[model samples]
Target: MMVNDPNLFWFGCVLWLVIIWLIVSLRHSNKVDSPTESNTAGAREIEELRQECLRLREELQMQSKQLKTDFQNATFSQLQTLLNNYPSVRKMTEAKPDLPAKNLVSLFTSLDNLLASWGYEQIGSAWEQVPYNPQLHQPDTNDIAEGELVYIRFVGYREGSRILSPAKVSRTLPISSPSK
Candidate 1:
């Protein structure tokens, strides 16, 4: 019985050593795994931040493009308003007849230059006579013949295929001769 007791004591010591080794190994492994998990979480957060930044940049670019388009439209609207007012001034000058021809020419030339810069162009010339066509001219009165055209009252303007304004014109009728 004494010899069996010594054997049992050594067996118990070996078993305790194995249990302590296992516990230490498990703790070391847990420490290693915790750092890896934290690193993965950090990488995920960084990726999310990057995606957010890209989305913000795209939004900013879209906003800038919209602003540019709005500014261009506003500028075009102002130019159209200025062009619309020119015909009244031109008519007033014509009525006076005392205004110098050179002054009128200069004013028209400058206006033409401004229009050309903005992709707009005058469609007709003053005193131009052409065969009457309903598509290009608007008649002021219906008293004259249909086929004839006299001096234009106001010139037309166009941009691309769009007509900004139509020409105002009068038609001339041939005078009837007395019976032979």
Candidate 2:
């Protein structure tokens, strides 16, 4: 029973070495788990940001579509009012021609200016004696003879590149001055 028996002391030293090894292994495991947990948290934050971006894009698209719809509805309503006012405004064109040429010239200019104010542009004119064109004019009668545009009652009106309405016209056979 020696207090410093070599076998017993060596056994105690070996036990202490085992205990140190266990503590070091537990510390290393905690370090590894800490990094892995941090990576998982980072990945979760990135996924949340992606979800938020997708939601914002959807909201922007919906707002853009609504704005487009509202604009179209407003344009249509304004166009309806314009069309309703057409007859009164059109009377100016017919009435101006009846005035004296000197007065009518100024009146005609004023009429053109007025039509411009209403978004109309006179593209070209046709004699009341030209051949009928279905593309340019809607014929009241297909049986009517060619070279006989009897009436170019109103000239075609256009806005930008689009025709709002074709000129209303009538056709007839050429007037024969009694061939003598």
Winner by TM-score: 1
Error of 2 at 61 (Å): 16
Global lDDT of each model?
0.60, 0.52
Model 2 gets an lDDT of 0.52
Best by lDDT: 1
TM-score of every candidate relative to the true structure: 0.44, 0.32
Mind giving the per-residue lDDT tens digits that candidate 1 earns over 1-180? 454544346655765665576556556665776877756655665566567656755765687678765774566566655564456445545555566642654566676676677677665654456666566667777664557766465667677777767666766412321122
Please write out the lDDT profile of model 2 over residues 28-106, one tens digit for every residue. Answer: 6657778777566556655665576567557656876787657644653465444333432444434444434434333
